[model samples]
Target: MSPEISVSTNEHKVLGACPHDCPDTCSMVITVRDGIAVKVQGNAEHPATAGALCTKVSRYTERSYHPERMLHPLRRTGPKGSGQFEQVTWDEALSDIAARLQAIAARDPQAIQPYSYAGTMGRVQGEGMAARFFNQLGAARLDRTICASAGAEALTQTLGHKVGMRVEFFAESQLILIWGSNAIASSVHFWRHVQTAKRNGAKVICIDPRRSETAEKCHQHIALLPGTDAALALGLMHELIVNDWLDHDYIARHTLGWDALRTRALEWTPERTAEVCGITVEEVQGLARDYGQSARAGQATAIRMNYGLQRVRGGGNAVRAIACLPALVGAWRQRAGGVLLSSSGYVPVQAAALERPELLAGRTPRTINMSTIGDDLLRPASPEFGPAIEALIVYNSNPVAVAPESAKVVQGFARDDLFTVVLEHFQTDTADYADYVLPATTQLEHWDVHSSYGHTDILLNRPSIAPLGQARSNAQIFRDLAHHMGYTDPVFAESDESLCRTAFGDQVDFDLLLTRGHAPLPVPEAPFADGGFPTPSGKCEFFSARLAARGDDGLPNHVPNFEPAGADPRYPLAMISPPARNFLNSTFVNVQSLRSIEGEPLVEMHASDAAARQIADGDVVRVFNGRGTHECVARVCERARPGVVNGLGIWWRKLGRDGTNVNELTSQRLTDMGRAPTFYDCAVEVVRV
Candidate 1:
């Protein structure tokens, strides 16, 4: 393609996609001038993004050209975590890493572990070549279950699929429930659809522990206690059944275990549920009444289910209980009435081709859960546990700031024996502890494909600008490593274009995808309207025998978390750490603009709770528990529940007053069904410092 300049002198436009850890997967149009990227905006041609990018991504040029960006490979010159390194050539770095990994794999394959998450999220850079190399080396397999696994598992058990209502159909809804999600901040593109739905006479309701940005904008906010959403949902079910509001026909024909679910729900009375959830009995009954009326009146109601609810010990069961609500009310019969967990499955990618798991040659490497990184890092080598983690190759994640039990993770990183290799665009909190830090290209300088979890659009990205300095894409780096290691696998030889085309498969046209920014994936008009589920029973399993076989309750019921909701003598305050608006995990926390917009990280508690502790607003406070302690300014408001306190996550350790992060207070305990980390099931007490 020729360089097409705009009316402005020396200005050219290049197409790409935002590669942040977001569900939007927004297509971007970058403005380039004289070999430099000057601006970035959302592609108007894209259906989901619709010409509007989020606040954090609008300043892409600032982050891409930031002075602090890592522009070359470097080897540690001082002690670990000292952020002191000397420059090295790519060949030298790759050859050294390959030789070390080969030596480690010869002794025990499980000795090396590759750590990453949605930091890139692009199909190729996210998993493609890295997967091939790891599988070929028989390194420890990482279970990427840090974020949405538990909620996805619960939704799959109830709906038989993780796919949800088409986001374009949100405007057809008469009532929209934003449950445990602050779409306005996390998924700004989808928030536009909700705004349109509101304009179309949809009543918006937000259910969360804190009054988030979305809750503030919605017509109603149901602030419940943390980890008590299951009790509230079951109470609504009891009202739907006892008050004769349930669709009997829908239950009899399309659902199984109606009697069992009814019996279980009946045990949760509105009063009891209200007490558990810290809401009034009338509020619980009101939600049930409104939902029943909407169903009876043929008005569609949509539930936007987010991952926050499934971050507790009872999180899986909580999701199961909530997902069963739409079926009882016959909401799935309407156009957009069903619960929308995630739209990722709506667009299928050819994963077999991209990952090339055949590289492992039928050798199944030991699987390690990402949530238990701290535990695995600290564990000693043994015959039962395989070899202890000797080499830690980090990318697309900052576990030091984001992982649970952060103090323990730091301790593991401090080990002199651990050989840490980090690929990053900046010297992040985690990179400070690395033995070698390799510079990585920004999204604008990479070629990859992206699919949205909030919409069914598959978008393609092309390199908008040259990679700054000596930075390379993750795929390029891995390919270099494979060549240095003398690996002859054909998978490593595959080009990025070939891999992208392979991921699209024969079903999609690659040329057409490049012409247009995105294309909608083919799917049924009404996924569950005819009541044919993919489950064994060919119907929605209200009482999942699959779950029962796994030693869990078949019926959807409330399960208690590790921390009791009631006030305790030791730790009276419940800690709820959620993502902040200006940053995605630890991604943009280092950016000066975003950091200034977000201000300082602080602890938010109810005014009543603050009074009890004799802590005033803006007072520097120390929040502590058995796990660890952290200090921050206090923010007292009605937004937080009386016994609950909240904090924004993924702040750098250096920025905090006590040199600790929120994850220092989080637990490594797993959820009931999906084994996901129970991050929100934590307790702490805050006092004026």
Candidate 2:
């Protein structure tokens, strides 16, 4: 169990960013000889990973020196969610969290919030200094709408814009539609360009209710029935409008509402969407005739997408009904068709790469939903939600095995009424509910800068070692917590080469990705002149008057709902976890060549429902309900389908802290554009004890 050691070529390779939550932000290089990093790869002039890299990022130099990483800071002397710390000294853990956050901002500056997500999505971890220490303590705002904000708020309320499409025309696609995503266990370099567009002839398919390995190496897989994918995508837009294969001059020249999307796609027929989509009436009419004949050969058919189907429950109208399938077949006028959705828009060979912190200049900070932040901190003692979340800070997150009620976020970080800090590198499940843990680094020991989730290529990480203990870099702990809370504007005049020249803002060769670590993005062979469409009636809306003042039904819709999961007729199967050990959310479960390809927390059933509950394969089982239970092992299977139950997500439970964490039987039931249900309805039953 000791493989990583590599380091040669006169070392000093240095380059960075693999920060993680990956989208293919690869770029890296690392090497770093004596100072450390050791060996890393993929940067062949970046442009959305040209030199390609995988196997959990060329083994990110064995998570720097992972032996359960996390080096200094500590402090919890057994109590605040007791994973029992002790270490201390970064000046006694920043003078004990700056004397309890300056006595909670000397009482009320919105009593501090500061939590974070993507566990490092990067843009210098969103230009650190923790947004100037949460606006010098005005705090509270932290709600990354619990996972891809319901598909980037339904593609920014129907394509006013958000990130999508661009990974170099995914090999001139001719038909790809994956949905509820599984791109070979979470975007393995966007399934290597959909297996190089199915080795050139194209046509991938997939969908999902579980059969995955990208639906067993796709050719056409379906599965269906987990929040019934907006009823099989409005019954494939009602078989692309009862077979006339509606493109009506690209929906009457560019599109807007088109008779309210043909009156809500004529109440989706095909036997009423194969009766609420359990699937098949000829597999929803052959996936709406292979996705409306994927750009009728004249072009467009790319779909690389992933955000794990916006974590379910209408997931922002299932990401505006799967990004309105390349504007219903014009496939965004081809270049390999459309919808990669974000590899940080592929970076500036031309320009624009997803900004808008409202356009940043401060002030929009009211957030909360990071999956109901441990039920808004265990219901502030139930006085109908008020005070009590006293202090939280955490960064490069881990709301206990990826939040969504993971046992009321481990009882609101094992309450004594919450204090938590985290900023980790492992010891995570939210650093076993910290009260101050700190450490950090890894990705070969930090220097960071990233962006990509399928490809645009924003790299530059460069640490490759040293500092494995008094660990640093979340931009030097938000610039030493903004010089210990004194606040210095110019947004604390940031650097890492000026946050890579403000992530190439309005580019004009914004350092051409610092000497080409990865650049290419303009995609203009006429990237739209006549087919305009940028929403507010400029076209391509499919009925979205800004989600018609938010009540929905503004077309681009698809509703089948589901995720209730607890009517307990002794638990009639239904559970699916996904995100298995290429270890994003649990930092390579203590990396050891990726925990020997996913270890522990089993369950996965199917073998005739595990031989009708006689279980077996490593049997231990439990899975329970009322709100929580977990003991795991199970794994029997027929490629999962029967009654269902599977597991692979975060898994940090190390022995009874409200037992078996599967977010204590998840289902905080969100997603109208907030997302966090993690697909497959939740009911449970499987027992073997």
Candidate 3:
């Protein structure tokens, strides 16, 4: 919808969208006064946003106008990682960067890698032009799997896409399983729906290793061991089968390979599942009873899953197992039933048209997984490895603080021979090592369109103010670089507004987005209610033939973590680094107000573990494993379950006690199905420092 701008002298409000890596891609109203954005608020008319904004995003004006906001390009004047630079003109920075990249491309374009993720979820700013630039250069393809890949691939294998029940329907669910998610911290909008259901006498259960804020408020909290979600899921299936609480007709008509899955599920009795999950048999049986009884009573049952549970070795199989639950109880028949990990597939994004991958001219470059950058960055050039990464263009992500095995990641970024250019709004940990730093425009000063994973709305962001200082949009920077490199493609000249229009082609109404600020897709209220899943056979697959063709197990099963709890006496405790409540990955860590709210990096441990290590609340502790060690304050609290420590993280490495974060102890090992990092599949030992 066109922004309802009531022009009064020099003040007006411009409709925009939050450009952060959050599930809630909120519709925002940037209140501008005399060409300055004075306020940012959620759009009251957007049903999903409901006029509410997260604390981090509500203070966006503070971020954009902060004294430290990057306003010009810079060239490194000191040693890499020294955080020393001299301001330079945009012409000088782009020319130098383009020349270096062109020289690297002359040898092998594949050696120049683009490192980016959901820094800005906008199609235009995120990858619209950047992807075109990289495709034209034939740079090494980045398998952007730092988040959600394991669960996304699992959904594809099981239900054919990352499609799910509508988010609004959760408000009407009678039984809700808050699986692997801390909705209060990460998905606040979804939590609103769950709260509505709670007020309506719905029962909510939180299943996670840590007693998260959401878990504390739920009717029940089952703190199972990390990476044992598949075991618990199978246990629920066992109870459902034994009690005959399943919809046999739905299972027979809307699912495939049920006999094989049932056989495997029956093997996981409550006793075996409890042992594997480090929970009581009664907890397992009780959860199954709640879910089964709700379904048998013809009440709406739903599952809201998040990425926290998929940062393990068996993450994909765990997702597949949980995704199979709704089909067993015929939950899809109701609008408020079924499960949702992501709603991205419901929107038809014209990625190929927007990115223009045909610019590659049929060249198949080697792909590098972003999750394993700790190892991949240090790999030597070989026939197998193709070429050592010569130039890295970092945008929208901070790898030094967020990627696994930070010690190795630091070593890779500190290489003197590697040419690095970072497009950023501030001097992030990754930017500290860059040869050049280019200032990128904030969401308030850019034109972009967004697709969300949490809802089915397409949001449009219009520039409320002109570019601040010498800042440029990410797309404009790439366009300038393309010009300097002498690339003469018409697509390179497309404006950001034009790129936004091309993002969805005819699938979404661009005119409606321009006028209303947001538009919803025409998706069914209950998409899979009639057994017409988007799978090959038009039904949910209990056993994925696609996996069988790839020589993997056809049926979902519990695969233990690489470093299971109690697997090694030396590192007996399990650790999970969930995002700090006030921060999203490493984005808001540098914001003063938010940082004040977070205070400092801290690790949560149960009293027993703290006592054993001679640690007390507020005492500095060393969390170390085979990989490396990180220092942080310890909080002996109930939030951390027994034998598990919750490291509130994504804090900037420089802010930590020992110049490292929890990723210092995480591994570069990939998961079972997706080549994603196992950030949570880690074992550690703690000691007072």
Candidate 4:
């Protein structure tokens, strides 16, 4: 263990990719001296990434060397949820996890649910391998499609497929509508492209309930009410139809359900749209005409929307409403036109996830929502639902902190019936709830592939240095766990190289592709070159018969559903938890610089709202509903809409330790199919604490 092996300065250089909770997943290079990562820089040669790293990820080396990181595995010796654990060796930790998991499997394999979210979007690791392993083991299906699936389902219902155009398409787009998405704060590189498109004379329009940073740069702003996006979209379509601006020939030739759509849209004229959508009629008319009559000769006018992430209630219809825009104008027929719910390609995780039938071949039992993990543990219909969930394996997420109604998730862990296992570098909110905390190496200590949701390129991730301490990559841990579980199949027998090849399958040779940092799929040299479609109907359905058949009725049906967010006139304002540019969930809250500048968690309000409440900037205030209580500093900022309040999500209970989590108030109610929460419009009241 001596420092006998003297290495050159160049030997310290390491190559890796950013493992952020973002779609950009930019490739990076890290220079390590001794055991610590020093200089962090972008890898210029990385494909798709353009060697770009965001401010949050650029200083990741600081996160690696963060003083608060947990170095060794810990075993909770005290009562569950007591935040007490004793440091343990790797052998004890691994053996304990294996033995404990085996006991749970012996009792009921379905009890050991692997819960994870969009911490790492790559397929080879995170939930990809983990799900495959558990599926084979006949475990519970953790259907955590909480973030993107609602939009995907809506798009699939209307468009018959869920896919976005190439990132390069932004360069060709003549008109851009950023709806409920702040690309500049959430995606710095893509925002640069928006600026580029604007310079090229492509008009930009931002439609959001809040006048976000993206809205600030737009030609016009549609500050509609939360959950009202669909109404406005339908109204806009009505405007297009009234003015004869729609591509009628395109609709007649390549789409169905036009009559139904027209009928439904007529019900949403500008007057009705103004009432429901809460935007001015003039703004609605101008926004509709600007996009419907684009000068771009392409088949589609480019609109890069975030889908329905901002919905508080009526989330699914919100997705259905906005997604219908492209087809009305035949935007998909053009090069720079199409709805971008997600830029990560369809059939993600490649064919390995599809071809591997080892886990899901036979009939699997019940499925549970990711947003409702607490209910799954507490109210399983199975005979032993309460006592069966003895082991829970978590990777790439801090669900106890990130999931809606996270306080309940912690309470579920407090049950002796629920055993928690978390793989992470730090004792995250989820980790502290675990019986055993597994040491998961940072991206700086591992190798993997990057599948960006913002761009088309398949990025290659190279390990910058050796695993710090005894920490291992999630893939390595799963591979080892599979070995311990006595899975001798040829599929499980594959090495990282073989597994990655299986992951990529015949599509691309991973090792060769990794050398260049990425491999981009070839888009049609020209948009809509030939007549082809994936659905049974050989064309895009202007009005989806499938949706109509499925009883969705295809015209973005506007109906009120039971939602967690209901107004109490006493609490006149709605609380919105918007994405923070400086942080992703609770991951970067431990970092010094980002958290330092963000300061303590703050409840931001419009100046008018603040004045009405007689609240001023820097005032400590307590916000509460029937659900829970949270106290934070208040800032009078116009960023929050007049009647709406904005609070950043998952600041951590330990940081302010007095419930900084927004989930303390968010309800676990979800969509039937997509299970995504209507988080934007939850009602709450605030007062000086």
Steric overlap count per candidate:
0, 20, 5, 7
Candidate 1 ranges beyond 4 A from true positions: 1-9
Residue lDDT tens for model 1, 1-689: 22234747777887788888788889888888887988898888787888999989999899999999999999999988888999999988988988998899899878899999999888888898888888888899999889988988887898786776887788788998889998988988778889988998889999999899999999989999889989999999888888888778888899989988988889999999998998999989998888878887889988988989999989998998888888888888876788887877666788888888888888988888999999999999888888899999999999998889998899989899999999999888789899889998988898888887877878788887899999998998888889999998778998876777878687676776777767678866567777887778888888999999978889877788798655567997888898888989888888899999888989888999999999999999998899999888899987688888998777998777777889989989999878799988888999999
Clashing pairs in 3: 1-515, 1-516, 1-517, 2-515, 2-516
- Among all windows of ten consecutive residues in candidate 3, which has the lowest summed lDDT? 1-10
Candidate 4: misplaced stretches above 4 Å?
1-15, 32-36, 295-300, 307-310, 351-355, 359-363, 380-388, 509-511, 525-531, 559-566
Please say which candidate is ahead in lDDT: 1 or 4: 1
TM-score of 3: 0.99
> Positional deviation of 624 in candidate 4, in angstroms?
1.7
lDDT of each: 0.86, 0.66, 0.94, 0.70
TM-score per candidate, in order?
0.98, 0.34, 0.99, 0.93
Ranking by TM-score: 3, 1, 4, 2
Q: Is candidate 1 or candidate 3 better by TM-score?
A: 3
Which should have the higher lDDT, number 2 or number 3? Answer: 3
Clashing residue pairs in candidate 1 are none
